[model samples]
Target chain A: MTEPMFRTPLRRVRGLGAARSGTGHFWHQRVTSVAGVLLTVALIVIVISLLGRSHAAAVQILGSPLIAILMLLFIINTAYHMWLGMQEIILDYVHEDKWKFLALMSNTFFVSVVGLASAFAILKLSFGV
Target chain B: MADYEARTSSGARRPRPISPHLQIYRPMLTMVMSIVHRITGSALYFGMLLLAWWLIAAASGPNAYANVEWFMGSLIGQLILFGYTWALLHHMLGGIRHLVWDTLHGFDPADREWMTVATLVGSIGLTVALWVVGYLAMGGPR
Candidate 1:
């Protein structure tokens, strides 16, 4: 067989080890985290504005397309970012092998449920359904 | 390195130290604050369910929404809301701390401590100020 072109001697010899996904996960965590901060601030402002208001008043405010979109965005970012952060926490602390695996799975599941529920609620309100 | 390989292959029993953690190190301010940061981050997870519930209730109907709104105005509900507010503020400050670190600042011992203190104080101050403004916006407490 012909030798592969542009292969370093090391590649031809020892070769590369595992291509870890750690870097992608790290960058994603940071990007989502930054988005989360902005969305969270927007949400806090919305909630504070709604405080002491009647249900109709609050709903009217949220029904506005801008607020509804922002709320949905906030929920999505928070759910994903929270999942990533919780996954790191569980990985670091949950030393028990079985429990660690279970906790990791639960983290994803919980965030998914929360995301779906919140997104559906936002859509329902936005569409007046 | 060679000896490490040999030890592993030989299957000789060796004493291994337990993980370095809270017991090994003296508690420091940053240590306590860092743990609190994680706690607040986690708290936001559960606390946010309240927001979800409110939205769902609102989408359901005006009457259903009012049920949640009324409860939120109750004394106990207010307390929980207050705590949730603090948690949000605190966690936000912690996030800022992380962002600052990301920019390659605050790695110095003194600066890190100062930022830690600022995170705590700033969150409390901001929460109180926001609440004050919120109450004022509503034309003062009823």
Candidate 2:
């Protein structure tokens, strides 16, 4: 067969032209979205169970290593999924170029801070530190 | 480069036309509600961080836990909690509606309309029920 006429770097990458790399983000967001749906229900049940209990009782529940680990995972995944969803909303509605950049940056920063703080809290609680 | 010219001349990289956007379609109640579900779902992400903080602080010590309690007992905290509860209910009902749709049911226009309406009403109902339960748990209006 004759050699392919076009050898541009962009053309060499499979599925990289015109279609964009959005499919990965889209699929990831959906996967995490479904995960968040399940996690949220479990979280709500946990919180409701804790309600009306004294602060000390709540502490005992959270101090369990198992609960701490689950909370950490939930926080991280939830923040990441939220960030992805908000990015889509910002990209859709924020028309100004500068504002869009700022929005994206702030979104990333907000989610990161939330995730870090939550993880730190869980670790401190689990370790009694 | 030769490849660049070849691709360009061959019209293999022409700008693709974009389809019309949301402006072309009339707004509907279901569409608005669906968007709201996403907005509230996003809000809960940040809200859960607060919950995690409270739980952690409670686990940490009396001092740390007291601080969280003080904040959550304040007027502002109650207001925030109210909003959080409503958001939770809204997102929960919205999720149930999505699960129904996933099962390939509720496709009819009338069913879709009823589902949307039910979610809104169910959210409000659940919020009210939770508050009532909370009130009773707190000794019922003193």
Candidate 3:
């Protein structure tokens, strides 16, 4: 089959190429992987700092602006990276078309839920709400 | 055909011939590491859920946060936390390994073997060292 072209601007902005060979997914995954590595270190610091501390103290630590922001970034990137990683796994393993589509949808939903849930918690704590 | 994705997209359906699975190929250290990399990545999914719960529990107020904290302090929780710690470190090393490959070097057999061993050793060493520091930080309570 020949490659499909999108004359529409909306589809073009989405990075779908003529051969569907866009680098967006690869780029996102790599960028987030690097970010996840750095953020993971920052996360270990926060956890270690929280160790043996009270609930109030832990909350106070997490609610700090810097920790909250870093944690949010870590959570968001990790979830998205996970979605990309799992998508590749499902594509490689799930051969049947029906199951593949279903699995893909579930992957998207699951990642979004995890990301959103983490973001909400972080934002709430950061705002001291 | 190697273009199985394209063929299937065109609505002609057949039992898509898959490339050789691990069964057909003799498992080497590097090959095993590749599969281990994938498994570690998947392991982080559940680990992420645990993290999310911890964060939410912290935000939810004192008692809720205390309950989650206590569970994490329990025996099974400690074991899971230990595994999570190791998995995170292992996966991070795996990511670094890939990043090195992205530079277009490290494809030689020796380099590949060296990296697989490095990742395994580095992750295990880091996890153990971190736990030791953690224990000491707790004033030798354990």
Candidate 4:
């Protein structure tokens, strides 16, 4: 009926910390993961459907605001989710502390850069900028 | 100076276990597949940048866009694009597998192995199927 004495308090809280904000990241990752799964399949379908099309036709389809918006969402979520997953991989495998920190920082920066750049591109194409 | 001071202060800091580390543990297919998923995911990050570049260039003008079109048409560029296509498919399948696991299922030893195998085979199959479609649509000429 009683808890084991040897079980440390830290062990109990290893995954359940007081810091709740981290859960937001975890939840968002899962949400985006689901979104990415659907979007990736849709993307493949769209690409295949567009196959054998002329350049102008391809551009016209991609230029639609609806397609632009979906592409924007897909790019941003994919980049962010990839960054989150890569961060975990680096933390798990990179033994050098300094290198791990650098990897984490670089991953964050790279994801943000790619996400922003992709959004910009989509906007440029959609709005003729 | 600040780093030096911090280093001196932290010099006495106990060496912590950085990571349990893959070397310390026996290699498993699941672990290898997990790492591969990450590696491919990272590669797709850059691949998206390529997509962005193409989009932006196409929006710019004929001359500006032609540069990207030319590169993508080149043999070397096609090779890279093929690799990215496979990476994207691999990572996407791996992600779906993780999502299935998160639904409080598929953690059984046999199920886990089957999921891993499925991820691998599915990714390769999807990539090849898409590339075949792409090739056929693009025409027989390389």
Q: TM-score chain B for all models.
A: 0.83, 0.82, 0.83, 0.82
For all candidates, state DockQ relative to the true structure: 0.39, 0.19, 0.47, 0.38
The alpha-carbon deviation from the true structure for residue A28 of candidate 1, after best TM-score superposition, in angstroms, is 1.5
Q: Write candidate 3's Cα lDDT for A23-128 as tens digits.
A: 7778888999999889999999888888888888887888889988898888888888999899989988898888999999999998898889888988888887
**Which regions of candidate 2 are displaced past 4 Å?**
A1-22, B1-27, B99-105, B135-142
Please provide, for model 2 over B1-142, each residue's C-alpha lDDT reduced to its tens digit, 9 standing for 90 to 100: 1132223576677544557887898999799898999888777867866776786677567888788878877899878887898897898788778867867999899999999999999888888887777657656666
Identify the leading candidate in terms of lDDT: 3
Question: How do all the candidates rank in terms of DockQ, highest first?
Answer: 3, 1, 4, 2
Quote model 3's iRMS: 2.1
Best of the candidates, DockQ = 3
Q: For candidate 3, write residues B1-142 as lDDT tens digits.
A: 1345434566876675677866888779888889888898889876888988888888898888888878998999999999999999999999999999999989999999999899999999999999988887767665
lDDT of 4 at A54: 58
lDDT of 2: 0.77
Pull out the clashing pairs in model 1: none
Off by over 4 Å in 3: A1-21, B1-21
Worst 10 residues of 3 chain A by lDDT: A2-11
Better of 1 and 3 by lDDT: 3
Which consecutive 10 residues in model 1 chain A have the weakest lDDT in total? A13-22
Superposed by TM-score, candidate 3 places the C-alpha of residue B1 at a distance from the truth, in angstroms, of 14
